[model samples]
Target: MISRSVTARLMMPLAICMLMLCALAGVMIYAQLMVSSANRAALQGQENVTELGELRSVSRALQRDALNLINEPAGEARDTIAKKFDGRMEKFADGLKKLEGLDAHSFVPQDYFDSQHKVAQQLADVAVKANGGDQAGALEDFRGKVRPAEREASKVADERIEALGAEVEKLIASAESADRFAKILLLVATIVLAGAGLTAGFLITRRGVVIPLLGLQEAMGHLAAGRTSIAIPSIDREDEVGNMAQSMARFRDQLAAAEKAKEAQAELIVSSIGAGLGELASGNLEARVDAELTGVFAKLKADFNRAMEELQGTMQSVNRATTGINGGAAEIRQASSDLAERTERQAAGLEETAAALTQVTTGVKETAEGAQSASNAISVTQDQATEGRKVLTEAVTAMDDIQKSAQEIAQIINVIDGLSFQTNLLALNAGVEAARAGEAGKGFAVVASEVRALAQRSADAASDIKKLIQGSGELVNRGVNLVGQSGEAFTRIVDQVTEVSRLVKDITDQTNRQSTTLSQVNVAVREMDATTQQNAAMVEETNAAVSTLADEASRLEQMISQFKVGTRRDAPAPVAAPATVHTPAPRRSYRTQGALAVAAAPADDDWAEF
Candidate 1:
């Protein structure tokens, strides 16, 4: 299937090209409309020119027929000429009407048509006079008026026809020129659009498709070279390239898993060997390597089994020696147990003494702390009482200030009451004046009544406020007195707190001295306790060493028993003998050797597949 990038690259330019084509079509349509308009204008101009020429020809024919009618004898031939004159006049009139019916864009002016109409009328008049037997008078009228007017009208019509013909030619030329320009413009636009589409297609294909494919190729190369961690670009795209990259990503993941599994398999083998060796080092000769291994690990497993077999043989030999050592270790363990028991008893006595001393020291410290806490509490009480006194003093001062403010409020209320009384008097006077105005001041009188009522209410409220202010002032005075009493009470409390603080300070000093004496006694007991603890530690170490020896002997026997070392079932038990001390063998470092083994493996091969 075609990829999304390829589709977009093709469709985008195609769409743009379509739009350009549409625009070019629009330009052609416009050009067509312009040409159509020019053609219509040319046709109309030609028709007008043709009509004007006809009018001029008809005018000349009418003039000729009128002159001929006048020159002919007054007989049958004369009547025929007169009929011809009438026919010419009718034709001239019909032509003039047609010229006038032409559009206003016609070259002939309206005034020129008017002049032709006048000339036609004059010719008709001359024809009428000739038909009435006044031939000489008709001839004179035709020469002096009809013929001259007709010739002038003819000249103007001919000039207008020529001008209209020239205009038609110009319109045709312009239309052709515009049509050519439009075609050229469309051609150039097509070329430019084609070039742009090609260029864009190339660029999009390269960047969106070819470049991504190259990247995918490079990623695949890395994966082939065992670079499992390499990134495959364009995996997010919705195209063939993205599909390829995604496939590569999946391959990379599988490769990574395989790599990880190979490493894990190697690690599992090494860990199994290390675990068996570690158990052996910890005096467990029974430790064995067990794993479902393959490839190189299968060989490593065999080597591990051989090593274990050799180790088992060595342990069997050591087992015989441990049997003898076990007896001596038992005796030593019994002796150490007896010594540790006696030392523990002595340590117990010293521990009790030290605990008693620690208790005594803790009690003394508690008593001193209590005394100090009591002193601090008393000092805090004293300071709090002093602060209370200060707060009470401030409260009393605030009460006095409130009392003064209440008195000022009472004075203001009195002034408000006086103003209300004055306002009531003024309202009463206004009501009196409004009443004097009778019907004209009825509304004013009502307003004045309302004003008076409000003023009376205001006076009543002011009196109430004055009473409340006086009551508040009394209450404030009482509060000031109470605050003064509180201040006195706080002062007494401060004096009592000061006395209690002084007493606590004396007690605190005595307790501190007692605590110091107790601390010295506690130090001496702790030193004795430390010496006993050291002796007990020495006893415990001796006992632990003996127990360890016994455990080692038993563990050695147990370890050798775990292995299938002795082939003969009927062999007698080994005899007990004293164990001789032997220097330990030097430990071999396996870290470098294991690393070399890992490096020696065929890394390039897909071991995980196997």
Candidate 2:
């Protein structure tokens, strides 16, 4: 796999910037979750406060009702007292039951429970008295026993409800405090993370990218100035800069080798030429021009022979020496020109390598930015899920409270029905008494009958109310169950969402790592480019040097043109070789040790004859 690297020029800063962005995003998400939780908690607390208040009101109403029933007059006692007691008892019981269910979290204490139980017994005692035909006894019991007991129970319930209110207040305060703390923490985290990220970016730019490149620039300047011996630091980075440094070292090596080779060849040529001149001065013109004779000597001998034969011994030695020297000087000038051309070619190659490295650096930078963006997105998702969970929990709680309220309504309906039943019985008795009293009781008997009918209607109404409330309770129960299921499903969703967020975070983390690595690689490529550029420049210089040699060979041919070595006295005269001419060979042929370098020379090419 081709591992991604940070191009030294851009990697370090990009990484630091991305990391900081991720941290800031995390802090934002944290704050969002805290705020959401606080809002839900506050809303839930308010709901509890409202439900508690309703329960307290219901308790107070029941208490007042019991007292009013007890205070009724004798005639009213048999009618209103019994009727009211029945209706109120059912209402009180149903209300209490509903209150119990509504907010179990806000339940009245055990003391209240005990008190209410005594109140119920007193109520039952009054009913027994009335059923036994003791109207006065029932009235007395309601006034002396039931009312007082119910008042005590109401007091207990009031105290319990008050306590629940206090608890709700505390929860609200706690949620507010948590919200504040989360905000502060998020702020602090953001500041710290931002600072750290900036610092990291600066360091990366300064040390990892900028500084190294500067050093490389200096090294290159030195090399261009012909200071091949100047030493450069060996940065062992895995980035482009490191690669360039290594490449530069290799280029330096090749240059040094070429320099050495040129020097050695020059010295050998000079010595051989001097020796050949001595032989020519002594008049021994038949010395073989073989490989043993260096470049300088061979060219000198060839020039000397051409001059001596043409001048016909008049100024042979003097002229040959001067021409030989001139030829050697020309060859040196050609070598220099060749070196310059080679150097230019090497520079062009280095430029190409540098361009490639720059591209690598850009790619690494983009990757880092993408990673940071992904991390930020993940953090946001996590916060949303947290808030949703809190809301779901609150909804579940509210539904439970509503269910309890429905049950209380059912109880109140039952009590009303019971009261109506008692009223009907009393009316029936009054009707019977009027009928026994004859004509004087006729009007009273009609009133009694009307009372009976009203009681019957009231009873029917109460029964219908009870049925309605019971149906409501069933619906509420079903709703409660559904809410509970929904809450559970929300919980699961939150869990799954959290997991997905975590996975996104992990992906971002891995991307960050890869970005860092790519930065290093980019740096390496840049270094390689620099080195390759230097190497190519050196190759160009070598090619130029070769061209100079070819040019010098042409000049030697021109100097030798003064000779007519192969022109027979009876044959046509040979034309001097063209300065830049070349003759292509059809095939390659080998020569024996004592034989000439070329085979029987081409008759059409004069340069080949030499």
Candidate 3:
């Protein structure tokens, strides 16, 4: 037997081992975090040291540029040098700010930053003097104050860089020491945890696995040898061994029960077999054995009972079937007779239907061909109508354009008429002015009268042209309206032709479908005629078979009469009724003329009227 509580037995020791390992891991992780912190601190210290060095370098550069700016003559060169000096001063200030903002207060002294600020201020003063073109004075200031200040600031920055470097070195050393310590501690913890795990494993294996398994093995050996009298010693334990012991005890009890049942089953088998046989010998076919026994004996009991049941059931079935067969044989004979009569009548009907289908198929084929021809003609008519509609549409559009042109001509004629009237008015005014000049203007008056008459003639011509143009515009508009009407008529003709084409096509498709369907019907009718003839032959054979079946039923009845099925022996057998034949109804015809009537009625009235 295997241990059932194996997981529980090992859980505590494994859990402790895991916890120790977790603690060791946590210590290592903490050491790693400390190392990371140290590295960050060292990195900040290095940054501060670098900043300090840059600050010192920038201070020296500022001093040099300031000195050069003072020595440069009062010109563009001096201004350029002064700008460079100012840029250097700005850089020095930024370096100081960067150093101050660095997280290295522990390494860089505050007095170093203060000294740099003082040097920046002195440089600023020297830049102001040089920018004012006072080269001599600026030189004096740079020498007297800015140079000394920058030197002092440089000295302080150098000292600060050195101090920061030493601090970084110390941080690096501390990080290395911590790393080494963490490694040593992790190694020691791992060794101790491994030793503990080994010890715990040995103890658990000895206490929970080995002893219990040995006891279980011995108990299983006893069970294997069929020694139910042996004791299972680990039954009182609270582990997998105890469970195994309990299972063995249960198995032993079941075995004892099984043995008892075996003996009982043997006696039952003998008694049941004897009783059943006696009953059978005594003419009681209903006698059966009990099949409630368990294990291997149950199969024996069941088989014996099943055999007796099958014999009894078979006898009873045979006895009953003899009567049913007598009546069923009579029914089959009657049904066969009726089927033969129906088949003969169906064959006659099918022959008639085949002839009719042949005639219908011929008619449908002719109709399909005619409809196809009509469909083609209608398609041609639809195309001509469509072309006519296009021509009428163009005529309507042309009439519209002519109407617009006529209206434009009318407008121009009106403009010409207005100009003629103006010319006539100007000529009349000239005649009045000539009359005011008396006899000296007599000849001028005649010319003005002549000019007025010509103007009047021009006005008359323009008026006549305007009236003609207006009449033409009206006529064109009327022509446009008439053209529109003609276009609409053509559109209606096109629609009618299209509708006729659609209806003709539909008729053609329906005719084709009807022809196809009629062909299929004809084929089916022919096949049905053949099948009916075969059926008639089969029906004659069935009648002979029915008579033989009836004779067999009689013999079977006589044979089943021998078995004493625990019932009265003198019971009367049922007599079969006489057979009867029923005639079937006649089949209906599905001809293509009926389909055409349905298809043509709607299409001719609705579409063909157009």
lDDT per model vs. reference: 0.63, 0.52, 0.64
lDDT of 3 by residue, 1-610 (tens): 2233543454445467669867866776677777767866766665666577667767767776776666566788877887788788778878777776775466666766676788788778877887788777877887787767656766766677656656765776677677557645744564455455445644664566446645655654554455667887667765545554565565556545555668755556446555655665544656666646668555545554544443444345445534554554565466557656766866897698778778878998999899889888888888888898888888888888888888788788888778888888988998899999999999999998998898889889988888888888888888888888888778867765775677578668767866875676577557658766876786676576656656755765564455466532334333434444333434333322332110011222211111
TM-score ranking, high to low: 1, 3, 2
Better of 2 and 3 by TM-score: 3
Against the true structure, candidate 3 reaches a TM-score of: 0.38
User: TM-score of the candidate numbered 1?
Assistant: 0.39
Pairwise lDDT winner, candidates 1 and 3: 3
Better of 1 and 2 by TM-score: 1
Cα lDDT of model 2 by residue, 134-165, tens digit: 76787787778766876676576556545654
Ranking by lDDT: 3, 1, 2
Model 2, residue 80: distance off in Å is 73
TM-score of each: 0.39, 0.36, 0.38
TM-score of 2: 0.36
